[model samples]
Structures are given as C-alpha cells and as structure tokens.
Target: MSTVKRWTVDVLVNDDEGRTYAEACLHSGEADTRLVGIGRAKLNPADRDIPEIGDELAAARALCDLGQRLLVEAANDIEAVTHEPVRLRR
Candidate 1:
C-alpha cells in the first residue's frame, strides 16, 4: 500500500542595519520531526542597499542549510535501523 504525507516549510526573513537574517523551519507530520536552518547575509560598505537581494540571498542559504540538515537526519535514521554507518549524498 502507498501512503500520502504532507510536509511544510516556513521561511522568515529579517533585515536590520546592514545585515539580513533568515530562518527556515521544516514541519514533517509523518515523522513528527521539526528542523530549523539559519542563514545570514551582510551588506558590504561598497555594496548597494538592496533589501530584496539580501532577502533572497539569506533565504537561499537558509534553505540550503535546511536541506543539508534533513539529509543528515535521514542518514542517522537509516543508520539506526541498519546498525551501520550511512552516508547520504546531497
């Protein structure tokens, strides 16, 4: 039998001073797991003041971190069941 599952990810971005911060949170109902990823982008003194660019960069980094975390979690779970070391590719 096949089962259907739903997962959601929430991303929040904030800009303060010359820096931007982003946090990505993942909600997995079936596994009852919550994962969080954080990212930050800094504006250089010579760089232009573009809020959108910072937001995009920070959010992208956060999502990348979240993806890596999820992979690690999955690898751990697989190892737990297999009783051996497991390596997951990105």
Candidate 2:
C-alpha cells in the first residue's frame, strides 16, 4: 500500500529590543507531532537599517533549527521501534 500525507509549516517573525526573532512551527497533522524552532538576529547599530533582511535571516535560522529537530525526532522514533541505533538514510 502507498500513502500520501501533507505537512504544514509556518514561520513567524517579530521585532523587539532591537532584534528580530523568528519561530518556525511544523505540524504533521498525525501522531500529534508538532515541532517548533526559534531564532534571533540582533540589529547592529552600525549596520544599514533593513527590516526585511533581518526578517529573512531570522526566518532562515529558525527553519534550519526546525529541520534539525525533525531529523533528531526521526532518529529517535526509528530507534524506539527497532531498539537499535538509528542510521538515517539519504
């Protein structure tokens, strides 16, 4: 049997204390697995004032963190079921 599933990911950014913060949330909509990742980028006083750039950088960092979390969760799930060390396949 074959199956197809859709996952949703959302990234939100906010500015506070002269820094941009981003959070990435991923929902598989199955098994109640919801992953969240956070990132921040400080606004340098000497740097150009570009809000969009800060937002982009923070969002990218959050997504990268979220991806790492997903990978770790996958490894843990595999190990839990197989009772063996996980070797992630590419």
What are the lDDT scores of the predictions, listed in order? 0.95, 0.90
lDDT of 1 by residue, 1-90 (tens): 998899999999999998999999999997879999999999999988999999999999999999999999999999999999998878
Candidate 1: 10-residue stretch with minimal lDDT: 29-38
What TM-score goes with each of the models? 0.94, 0.89
For 1-90, candidate 2 gives per-residue lDDT tens digits of 999888989999998766999999999977678999888898899998798888998999999999989999999998999999997753
Whole-model lDDT, model 2? 0.90
- Runs in model 1 deviating more than 4 A are none
Number of the top TM-score candidate: 1
Among residues 3 or more apart in sequence or in different chains, the pairs in candidate 2 whose N, CA or C atoms overlap within 3 Å are none
